[model samples]
Target chain A: MSKLSVIDNKRCVGCQSCMFACSRRDGNAGLSNSCIGVKSASGIEGDLTVVVCRACADPPCAKVCPTNALIPKKGGGVRLQKTKCIGCKLCQQTCVIDAVFWNKEENKPVICIQCGYCVGYCPHQVIKLLK
Target chain B: MNAFNDTLSRVLYIDVKNKKFWVTERKDLFDKYIGGAGVAIKLLQEECPSGADPLSPENPIIFAVGPLVGAFPLASKTVAMFKSPHTGDLGESHAGGRSAVAIRLAGYGAIVIKNASDMPIYVAIHGNKVFFRDATTLWGMGSSLTAARVMREREIGTGYRSIMRIGKAGENMVSYASVTVETYRHFGRLGLGAVFGSKKLKGIIISGKQTLQVTNKKTYKDLYDRIYKEAVNSQVMKKYHDIGTPINILNLNNLEALPTRNLKQATFEYAEKISGENIAQNYLGKRVACAHCPTACIHLANLREQYSDSPYFYKTTFVGYDFELLYALGSMLGIEKPEDIFMLIEEVEKFCMDAMSSGVVLAWATEMFEKKLITENETDGLNPEWNNTKTYIAMLSKIVNPPNAFYKAMAKGVSHAAEIYGGKEFALAFNKNEMPGYHTGPAAHLGFLIGARHSHLCNAGYSLDQSLLLTQDVAPETIIDKLIDEEAFRQILSSIVVCFFARGIYNLDLISQLLATMNINYNTDDLKRIGKEIHAEKYRFKCREGFSFDKLEIPGRLFETPEPTQKINKEFMRAALNYAKEKIKCQ
Candidate 1:
């Protein structure tokens, strides 16, 4: 079984420290390349939702990839092959969770690799690794 | 590297006396200070001669942003450092908006302005070029809001532009003047606005749009999304977004730490009237946000009321209120009416004064009146009363311009006024800077006294004291030790230009990982070592300016008023000071 990044929204402070950390992990100092999304409901923030790839057994993103760039990994989830991607965003539009973040600079869709780097930065114990 | 390629291109050095501009790329300084307040502090220490008059032409004004500013999320604050006209010591303030982004994108890490202009002028920084335009028309502007509106319309920049302009208070050089950015947010502490005024610079307008570079693009995207998710969904930011900082009122009131009626008492008698819940229920009109901030914690409310003089008339005014503003201008001034507090806040904003200091000054004036120090004659025939928003507004306006002796005295800040009037004991200031809202325990007071910059966040001593109260009998030494450690750690965070709000999220291990990604090598031990060094450097500057923690005045009122942990003893406080002196000496 492949591990997935799990989120517990209750403990998050919305500092965006995790976001910066993720960007730094990629050798960037900005947020343009992050794959996760956090948005508050209405103007109130008590109920914040953390959205990330669910790493499904049968991912919808893989089915919509025209060039078959997105292939299911041996562990459990799907992976994107940048060389095969035609800059087509059909998979991005089809992903129900909106986990795929599009990089405007590169014209490519970014998805969470299920790496646990972000988990340690979450001060609230909101993010956990799930098997 | 070309000026365009290097992030630390060149510090724009402007000598106000000759109105000359020059640039020097201090790469070594950038590598060490890492820009923002860290760089500003170094510049202040080097340029500002000892005992240089803070309001004189000799005083240097510095504006700085970090290396990661334009390239990152949450790295959005521009730090302004100067010799405070109020504190007579190290003065530092930070404001968020498009200021940091604009400065960084404009390709400079620091802008230092020295000397005074013979006439009013405004500075415009466009890429590599700098222009100083005559602001004869904009001078003596009564309202900063109007100035910002006019500048926004006239300047060739918008959206990503930042306008930092002063109002009547600044032009008049009020001791606690603040520079307002984006019309609402302010670099609102010490007297940076006064420094601008001293330079005969009415305002500064900056704008830029430059794309930042990133390494390991794939990993960057993944991390960005992860952080954005947590920021938008985190419970820690919920309170800030919902009630804004005003929520601290309820929490502090419950803790019995709220400074009320000029620190005469801990909790206010009419605490409910000024609680965040009350303000949100009655007057929370709209919420605004800083640039690229997902939290949107800025709350501006409209208070509509029927005018007593007009038959069928109503006045609608927009006011921003938070915990510190409410505590300082409302309860601290003995004003219980929410509408009254809102009205006073509007007056402060219009004149562009530091709300905290203004409130403390008003409170001191009110106390002076009650004690019969000065009568109606000294007050220009206007009776100084508590909670009278109408009278308070009138007094504030008169003081900003100061047409008479009473108004002029009031303009000099509470500490100076108290010194002249012989009430230093209850002047309510730390290092000549007015106190913030936290008057709950020894931790808060001690933190303010000992913290390098004397800011609430330096060590958040009040919060520490509260935590200690819950756990065990916290000895004075334990409190001092904890505060020193926290303050040291915070120095490292600020050097990295990380916001204090994210302290919990950016632990030592996470910081190490993040730095690794940036190709900067550091570990937990490195952070501690660096933090200690930064803390020591700040103290070194403080000592150079003749600051002694042992010589620090512990206001007599603190001993009289019982705190949440119980009334602090003088002996214990003395012992704590002695220990702090030794600890600092060892550093």
Candidate 2:
């Protein structure tokens, strides 16, 4: 399966290479465009909690999207129709893991499309794409 | 030029006296000098008046990031420049946290802080806003880590902002204290923390978001992909990702270049216990990277400690460790065990002092104590014994707290301490900045003597020493020429604010390509010439501050110790330094 999973969180070093990889997939250079977010657990002192779309069977993000922009794919992950997205940000608030990232410049939601690009950048094997 | 072409043009000016702030467009400066150290030196020269005290109100703190910052990979350092409280001239240090990214995205090429605050404060920047928050509570905070915690909770913006703070030693204006960033990285050397403390500033918080633009999208993408692939495939980069800098412990020990027990020996018998392999095998819990850097070279040790008050309570502390620090706190101080070294580094972190200088001071004290140069009465009834972590730890507390006259002397660093305590022969400092953990040979010593900051990183003469291992022998003139050239080229790298670890990937050709994307035109020769120009400017500042080659001192301890190269002598070092001085004047 192409859907991503946080196999281990403790192994993460807060390198944010995965965040860059995600943004690079969307043709950007900085963190402002990334769909995956890695924030400190308790400031910069403790371990990092890697937040990314886990491709839930019944995604809350998809259900909260009023304009049907976030539709579930044939598999598990949700597909985004950019034109239909009204930028309500309701979907972003609904997700428990806060995986629905915002495109600050475009004012649109950046959802993971089940691509395994970021998994390659996680040197510690923290992120995985599984069946 | 348009705003996009002039991306690195904003300069934030903070007058700490009135706690007032303003911004000025410095495109004229950045256009000529580029950013980071290049721009920082110029700003320092313009902002700081001649004959001004390093700890006075006129000493301006200049922090700069380059054009490649936030726009390119591994160009992640923010260069800091001021009058050093340690050396009293041409202070320079660089830190890689979110600092470079935050400042760049906040739309400033450099930040200049002048005058001293009447009250303690920390600067908080978000977009164009600068807030002077009261830091009276944070001034005497037990550790820099706790202060960072309080500021982190108070500051806005997450996932991107940087929190830089000082600890008790800095508050006490200890000359070699450091300003720690993110609990791991630092504006680590040459008294940046003391400068911060002198200004009644506790820390700084920076946060912003402004997307970087490129001249040609396709060219940018192609170059980015090429560099990314090169960085990922590089064995050098992979090595950094694996064990980080602690990898040097075994290599330097094998070469007998690792300075141990204050250069009494070149190799530590217990090298393996504090090695990168050992750390990776046992305590390496995490590996963090600086902003926009794929090479996560920062290795943090996970130390499990039970509470002294409660047997059942345990806390796992993450302590960042690297080669220089491990050599300084571990081998040089005669701490054999990894846990003991980690604890020593932890103590250093708590006080926010320079690890290299701290270790040098302690070793000097220990050696003097052993030679019957001083009594336990001088050492506050604690024996200054090598390999005794307990005594060392107690001495470290005294160095920060400075409970007695001896501790007060130690707080000033090895040079000043030796000046007071009669260990000038074994002071182990160059131009007031303590020597790094390298006993390679003459080129290393010469580099320290002639280099702008007298820092090993200023001109990596240790590498030159190791190179001589294969070539057998070289003329002093040739060695001087080589190091001068290295220093000039490193000026450009620091101007670009790229981490020196990625020096292999960001070669001249690649650097040229990256600059082209940013709309600056520079070929290899142009880059080299510009590098020399920057070096000349920095030297001009140093000279203006009354630094001269004639006044530069070489510690007698260097010649007394035999190293791997075994080429160190007063005659060779004198000639090499003289040659470098002449060459620098010509440049």
Candidate 3:
């Protein structure tokens, strides 16, 4: 089992390289489908927050899903069962860290699948995969 | 058209007077000019009325991002074009933050804001919907930082947004007012803020989540990885990530090229105290990067102040500082302390003014006061003396609010102030816009005088001076030729909208390769031709706006001060300008 984790988020520069890479994993060139998000924690003068799935063992998002669309993975994160999802957004609401992103065009949840594609793109070495 | 090209060619035109917005397919413009500065100048010519007052509703504001913006590293800058209230001609500025990515993802290669709004408003573009939100409350905000924070709270798309707003300086229509992008970055040259003020626009909030598909996904990914690796590994980029741009302070000071005390002296006596290494070691809080950029070059300094009223209470502020900021607010003012520099930087940031212009203006005013050309009454009882941070801070506010006619004239720029006050000889400005912090040699000044936007970055003459002129004596005509060629080449880079810091990383060959991945096939020769054409077009707009190389005033202080080479003079400068003018005409 493996999980993606922020190594030292203080080093993060809010470049969104991780977010871009996550989106690029789908062979896309934009942020429409990225599960990761980075933004200023306060304003531009303050620190940045790199928001990714925290990989909870007993995930709250899975419990709230009406159709069990969010299947808990072996490590901690969950995999989306697209057939079961009805786009109610219950999983989005229940995710404590707000990591269950949305596909606005498809009205589907875009959860990080713990593939670790973004780890290679973190220029500052702020994120890594724990195996 | 390909999907990428189709999306990249859509231009959003907003008519604030009519409260109407529409998208036009500008594939022809993008096809010809690429995007950013190249496409923006074309749009400006089409929209702006001839000889229109820069602050009038007729002067249009255009923001353009390139095709490489969201897809490539370092392609993070957005080119802003308008008629400058400062220079009264072809106003152009570039800002890096999230602006390029936001504009790109918002599905617009360019956004042209036309006419004046009926009331104070901020335009919010979320995907396809455009909302003109009443910004009456936010209009007179004291600090641009506060305005940006308020806008952040009010707007949607926290993760995917770029908020650009003006502060009191902009709202008051100061000629050198800048539009603060995010909090750390800005369209920090010319009078874009004054243009925003004239239009009654308080801010613009842009955010979107549109997906972009490349012609070849494998190629894009491979190119992206290679570029990313190169950016991180490049020694030049590593220098930026470490000490950032402020590293130039010591180097310039050592070379005796740093403009100090209003160019009265070339080197500051206390340069080391406020050097980049000093700031990074002592005050550096964190480093940040623009969207999609691997090199996190933006350095913010932490200044902790204990409340005088409450002994135990302490407040810390993070102010972005760069080489230009350090030069403009530090050495140029003769300020010896780094903390004082930070304080001045914060005030300038709060006012949303161009730091270079603000510093040059204050330096001139200080010199005037020293010469007894003007009394304290002119400064509203504040004496603008060198090394006095308190007076400078107060003066910064006065420039924004403008208590007296002197402050009003000063707010316009150093050149305007000198025109009225009889200090035109020492007014360090090129074509009415304040000079950037570079007094390297003849080429640097020549670049400032002849460059399309009258900007140092327009051709980077200082870099040329250091690399070429310092090594050997070069003919003025040859220098002009080199400057023209470099400036023309930069037109393509700015169109691609890469941060000039990454100029070495994104050369013509690499740019061609990257564009190939996106299905916009243009070889080096085509790019070279287009670059020259764009440069010519910018000059055409400038000439139409009444700019002339022969008529430009050469600052006497530049000749008096000792640059590294010590060969700069009026005659050589005039001859170079003439040659450049003829060369541009031939082009």
Candidate 4:
């Protein structure tokens, strides 16, 4: 089992390289489809907060899903079944961490599948892939 | 979402007076000049009328992001063009943060804000929607930080959003006011904030989630990886990420090139106290980066201040510092202590005033006070002296919120203040814009006179002063030629809108490859030609706005200070200016 983990949020410089990388995996640029997000903890001068799926053991988003579109992954997190989704955005509200991002064009939730693609782009080693 | 080609040429225009907005496809402009400074200058020409008052409604505020924005690392700069209230000519300032990315992803290659509002307002752009929110309550905020935070609360989209606002200095239309971006980064030079204030624009919040697609995905990935590797591993980038730009303090001080106390002397004796190493070791709170940039160059220092009423009660503040800030508020003001400099930094940030201009203005005021040219009556009972952090802090506020005639005049800028106060000889301003941190040599001074923006970054004359002139003697004509070529090439870089710090990583060859991946093809010569054309366009606008090469002021203070290179005189500068004039005329 594999999952993405925050090594230390304090080391984050708010570069958003992870966010850009996350979006780039689907052969595009910009933050529209990024499953991960980063923003200032306070103002830009303060610590940066990196928000991503924590890959819960028993994901509440999966349990609350009316269509069963979000399937709970083995170790943690959830996998999306595009055919089952109804574009309801219930998973976006159910997630405690607010890590479930929205694909506005498709009108669906974008969840990380624990690919760990962003780990290599974190210049400060703020995040890592746990296996 | 449209294709990248179509979306990249879209220009969004906003009229604050009529509360109307429109979008147009300007493929012609983008194709000819590229984007960022190039497209911005063209838009400025089309929008701003000739001989119009800079602080008047006729002047347009232009913000443009380049082709590389949102797609490349270090390509995070947004070019802001307006008629400078400070220079009364071409005003172009670049800021880093999420501004460039936000503007680009909002589906605009450029945004033009025209006319003025009758009342204070903040414009929020979320994708294609534009909201002219009444900012009556948010107006008159003490700090720009507070204004931005307030706007942040009212807005949506966190990671993709950028908030830009002005403080009291801008509200009062101080000639050297700056627009703070994301708290730490800023459109910091030539009074863009004054323009914002003139238009009654309190703040601007922009956010978008648009995605860009490139046809050749494999090539794009390879190019991105190469650039990323270079940015992460380069010696230059490492220095920027580690100690940041303040590391220049010690080096410049050693070379006796750092301007100290209104250029009365070239070197500061207490440079070590405010050195980058000392600050990074003692007070570095954290480092932050502009969106999409791998090198986090912006350094914030933790400044803890205990309330006077309660000794134990304290508030910790984060103040961003750079080479310019260190030179301006630290050495230039003779404030040696890091804490005092931090306090001064905070004061300038609160007022949203350009740190360099504020320091130099105060430095001139201090010298004038010493000379008895201006007394306490003029200073409102406050005596200003070198290294007096408390008085300087007080004066910073007064400059924003003027209590008397003297402070009001000072707010106009050093050139205007000196004209009124009889200190023109010592006034360290180039074409009405305050001198940057460099007093390197003739090249640095000449660059200020000739550069389109009258800024150090315009042509990096200080870099040339150190790299070429300091090592060996170079002819004035040769130096002028080199300066022009460098400045012209930089026009292309600014068009791409990449942070100038990554110029090494994105050379002409790499830029060609990067642009190719974006489906914009240009050979080295074609790129150079476009660069030259863009620079000439900016100069044409400057000329139309009453800029004259022969009439450019070479301040007497520049001669008083000793530079590392050869001593520069008025005769030398005049000859160089004449040569540059002839060369530019031919171009």
Q: Which window of 10 residues has the lowest lDDT sum in candidate 1 chain B?
A: B1-10
Q: How much of the true contact map at the interface does candidate 4 reproduce, as a fraction? A: 0.77
lDDT of each: 0.74, 0.84, 0.89, 0.89
Q: How close is candidate 3 to the true structure, as a TM-score?
A: 0.98
Q: In model 4, which runs have C-alpha deviations exceeding 4 angstroms?
A: B1-6, B455-458
Interface RMSD of each: 7.9, 2.1, 0.9, 0.9
Docking quality class, candidate 3: high
- Chain B TM-score, all predictions listed: 0.95, 0.97, 0.98, 0.98
- DockQ-based CAPRI category assigned to the predicted complex of candidate 1: incorrect
Compute the lDDT of residue B17 as modeled in candidate 3: 87
**Rank by lDDT, descending?**
4, 3, 2, 1
Model 2 per-residue lDDT tens digits across residues B231-328: 76778688888887788899989988888888888889999999999999999877777877777788888888887999899988888899988998
Chain A: TM-score in each candidate?
Answer: 0.89, 0.93, 0.95, 0.96
What candidate 2 keeps of the native contacts, as a fraction, is: 0.43
* Number of clashes recorded per candidate: 19, 0, 0, 1
What is candidate 1's lDDT per residue for B183-290, written digit by digit as tens? 567888687888888788888888654445544456555655554565567886677778888888888888888888888888887888889988898888766545
Badly placed stretches (over 4 Å) of model 2 are: A55-91, A106-109, A115-117, A129-131, B1-6, B306-313, B453-458
Report the CA-based lDDT of candidate 3 relative to the real structure. Answer: 0.89
